[model samples]
Target: MLDNGNVVWDHSEPRRGANDGTSYLCHGHLARLREIVATTPKAVAWMREQLEPVKGDFEKTAPMKASSKLPISAAAVDAADETLGLLCSWAEYTAESIGQPAPDMSNTWKVLASADSTDGALRVQGMRSDGIATVDSVARWMLERIDVIATHEWVEDFTSELCDQRATNLARWPYEERPKPAKGIECPDCGHTTLVVFTPAFAPKYSTEPLLRNGKPVEVTETVNVYDRVINPGGSVSRSSRLVKRTKRYADGSPVLATVQRLNYAPPLLVQCRSSTCRAVVRESDWARMILQAG
Candidate 1:
């Protein structure tokens, strides 16, 4: 949503830089609505799997410690459901304004499935319980009918109302939350106190050590901490975290054991300047250097 208005392309005929056309306000709401509708069922399935009785569950004689985080997952599902409700309400309102028929919801349920792209335009297929097939062509309709509605005086007012609702709903989405800015820390690159530090989403943290299991060599993998000081900028040190496979060979030309490590799996901590015009970044490896330079 933070558009910096940087020109992305230049036209040769007119010799002018094209305006930035990447605003979430344009189609972000519809895209998010489709995403939530498609993924909510998966979240529901996962919740069911966690809550339902499964094989290997702890016995009544010695119950295992319950997870304290399970309720967070349930809360996330509720938030997603509420957000979807808001979006559907907005969609229904827009459909009404465009004179589109209201879909029947009496004895049937609607589910948004995979997108249909047979006719070159991308449209989400909504299956109803009563065998009625519907296509979510809001995006296509908007593109095709933009010119027709461009002159309508109510379009601006309607757009404002929709944007207000979208902003409220988007804020309620759990995954949309971002880390707060690191207070009073000047960005090394931009020299601005707008840096936000955050952990990498899915970084791996372990190396695989070879072990003998049932007379066969097996690899036992373990994970690492982001704070591990593996990167040494000074002296002779390996620079990249790419996967490395090493074999310790016997002096008589036989391999004794092997170790596999994906150093890249544990990505460096990062700090980014939130300033739109000065989006500077610094990696964990550069933190020491930046601090020394500032000192």
Candidate 2:
């Protein structure tokens, strides 16, 4: 558990007796890259707009003051220009990687990379020099665009690819004895037969409630319950549960009818092999077939 009360999986500890083979792309890594790819172009455009007025001020012989002082300083203008250039280069790189024609960013990348070392400082100067209202608008626009990209449907393709790669690699491991949920299985790295088990503690369930705008029911939203049970080799068990809510809204900001919940149980849990020297984890279905020969 984190200090913020969020439960996070700690994968930092190296697995005992694990293979020191070539590294592979995992789901988390791919998702992060996708976010950067999707948001860079939008961020670049937004930063350019915010810096346009400042650039105009810089070009003038006398710094143009808005109300009391100059709208933007020379340093702030330089920093914004550098940031925009870097973002343009990133956008072009991502476009090419996704099979799209790269944007013309030769001039953008030609700019020196050392113009601004701190993005936060540039933003602060921008906000202080140019009114706070303009800075807030740009900040909100950038955040909304990033949020849309983070939750976009295209992420599923990246996740599927990661899962497929993992399955293929795990298939190459040689097991001493077949794994089973009932009798347990031996660790692939170590010869230990003891393993920690994990199973669904509760059947999945959901409930819907009508959302109201004013006095009328606009739409229905559904909340689902997910539960998991983790059992150690010593028979000690722990459970975790969470409630997830799904909502939909129309373009006018009115709630829409609820959509059917799509339950995803990918990369199903595997028992944690309890060998101090070799803690190998295998897929639940694979272990069951290996031990019970269950179809």
Candidate 3:
């Protein structure tokens, strides 16, 4: 028995010796005790029972295929199970406390921070998690829940699991900062509007910072690239590109970093597209107002 939160079986084959017993290798979360338990394993036994039901449910509903990626569903808590009760209660409590929509795919769980009415003393009064606990007094709340403590012996791993997922989220997008237009960042010389990217204040439940799922690590991605071509009246140097996958913050939100990435966006022109046959360029605001319509 490994004390860390991770659980794995020491049995190399499907069938072991008649006397092998169900003693599997297990690792607990960081907060879990470090000793390897050789006794009738609590976590391993619980996991075997828990997974059988979960796996059956997925097979019936989400049916896994060899090539298709299996989608993660919210952990199904048995209504009568006390541990699930604790996990659920905490989920609701944290949700309400988080007050923001949800974590970004980057696992960067955003909080609903209020601007200080007077001096910027932390005005966090919402029901967020203990990780972002502005008030240190209640930090042990995750462990304090009766619902969690009543669950399987592996419950202590929640903190480690939660933190690991959050770290994976950071790896997906480490550069998270409010978008601040440069000091002299006026509109470009073009009559066409320039686009400014931003991260929004709202979050959705689907936004999660995950550590790992189904034996795979999740990594968030953002990409951007451009040829710095200053458009003047002379022969214009233009480029054509395939659309690059981008982490599109809400079109109606605040902006973030402006970094170069590998992309195929059409090189934007600095001035109005004056081509007589080309009706591409329009008013800057109008250009910004256009939307990409799906065929």
Query: Which structure is stronger by lDDT: 1 or 3?
Result: 1
Per-model CA lDDT versus the true structure: 0.41, 0.39, 0.30
Better of 1 and 3 by TM-score: 1
What CA root-mean-square deviation does each model show from the true structure?
18.3, 24.4, 26.8
Error of 1 at 165 (Å): 14
User: For candidate 3, what is the lDDT?
Assistant: 0.30
Looking at model 1, residue 90 earns an lDDT score of 46
Candidate 2 wrongly placed segments (more than 4 Å): 1-25, 37-69, 91-100, 104-295
Per-residue lDDT over 28-119 for candidate 1, one digit per residue giving the tens place of the 0 to 100 score = 22222223333333322232233322455456545546863323344433433443344345445656677875443332234444366455
TM-score of 3: 0.18
- Which 10-residue span in candidate 2 carries the lowest summed lDDT? 15-24
Off by over 4 Å in 1: 1-185, 201-203, 210-260, 267-270, 283-288, 291-295
TM-score of 2: 0.21
